[model samples]
Target: MEKSPDAFRTISEAAEELDVPQHVLRFWETRFSQIKPMKRAGGRRYYRPADVELLKGIRSLLYREGYTIRGVQKILKEDGASYVAGVGRGEIEPRKREGEMASAPPPGMSKPAPRVKGAKGEAAPAAEAPAQPLLPLGEVRVVVNRLSENHADMLRAALRDLGDARRILDPSQGR
Candidate 1:
């Protein structure tokens, strides 16, 4: 089980949990100015719970809601703290006009359902017909083997050229 960020996670751990890169988190720190994680000796970053939550909000805004980095920065500058708190506390609700609920997708244009795995470890459709089986493993293996052979041949040719150059440079070994 993974510990919460309140216990302080290394930058890599935070990035892994948040599904973002360490450089991205560093960039966000520069942009948002609210994600100040603790930097230890040798400049190792350790993220707190608040920082982790802020990262989650930023990710949701960027990836899920499709907000640009600048747009997210502006949102953070305006109401980021409160929004983060609200989302963390699960107090975020869609604000609709009286008696109006969020609209559903139009008929025949619904989002695809998640595929469920069958007992044989194959993906079965949630509804409707099962998807066609993918290309056989044997076919994929043959393709990979061919590619590997080509790569090995190229490497060998390059190495031979390097050896020739070395022999030329060290003239004592006659060509």
Candidate 2:
């Protein structure tokens, strides 16, 4: 028989609904301190509705959004489990972590000033930060994948440039 919407689910049921293995669910319990499943005799676990939602959020963050376990932990700490649950429920969208913008302006380009209401109720421009672009989940994955691939090349080029500069500065040291 199908269960009620508010019914507690077993570890296997929860794992199946989340499309993850039961062991993965068990592992998540260890990593996320916020996941507190009710334990009965024989140490059987029963996941409440809220717990399932939190797991879905964590799954989305790790697998779909490509966030590290530590990153997800920071989100749980800063934003709370309820916020994560909201993300799982599709009521809230996940945002990029600080310093991890997907659509940052190119270097040498300044961000636009923010618009504000003046004392006379006129729209005035104020110094506000640029808004972040809301990219689709698929596009975000592509961008992140490209960045990881290019990051090493960028670092290698930087190191080569630094070495060449050092050689030019100290000819004797090059020997």
Candidate 3:
């Protein structure tokens, strides 16, 4: 049974309201660390109103707006949680580039300022940035058989797991 919309909700309730399966909610928590819900003693997730709104924005970005997970994360970090959550409330719109949807944000919620570039057209550096060192790469090819389109999500998840394993095992990854 569904509870009042104004009240805090469990994972299942949030999933139902968002029209997504429960597992998808769990998956989003793994991909997006910004989603921090309250946890009870037994590890039960209880999402506050803000968390729900953020999740809705994330869902709209990924499923309806066709944004990749990394793209949404960048938007959240650069634009802020309120900005992304505004997308859920239909107050803000994600900027879509060439070959993407052209819907606009509501008035007064105009798109954020464009990045300023230097003389050579390179964007200005962020105020305080972390040291991003590149890892050494070696080509080691692997062949997989019978990966069908229906299993694409599973394949991507497996690839992500493999990447995590690689980062952990390889000392030079610097993750």
Find the candidate with the highest lDDT and give its number.
2
Rank order (by lDDT, best first): 2, 3, 1
Candidate 3: stretches off by over 4 Å: 1-4, 98-175
State residue 117's C-alpha deviation in candidate 1, in Å.
43
- Report the C-alpha lDDT of model 2 over 1-175, residue by residue, as the tens digit: 9999899999999999999999999999999999999999999999999999999999888877767799899999999999899888888899975553434443335355445566788875555435768443223212222344555455556556666666678767553
Per-residue CA lDDT of candidate 3, range 92-143, in tens? Answer: 9777733312333323455555675666788868784456564434333333
Best by TM-score: 2
- Candidate 2 wrongly placed segments (more than 4 Å): 100-175
1 versus 3: better TM-score goes to: 3
So what's the TM-score on candidate 3?
Answer: 0.54
lDDT of 3 at 63: 76
Candidate closer to the true structure by lDDT (higher is better), 1 or 2: 2
Each prediction's whole-model lDDT (CA): 0.66, 0.79, 0.77
Number of clashing residue pairs in every model? Answer: 0, 0, 0
Assess candidate 3 and give its lDDT. Answer: 0.77
Error of 3 at 80 (Å): 1.0
Q: Arrange candidates by TM-score, descending.
A: 2, 3, 1
Clashing pairs in 2: none
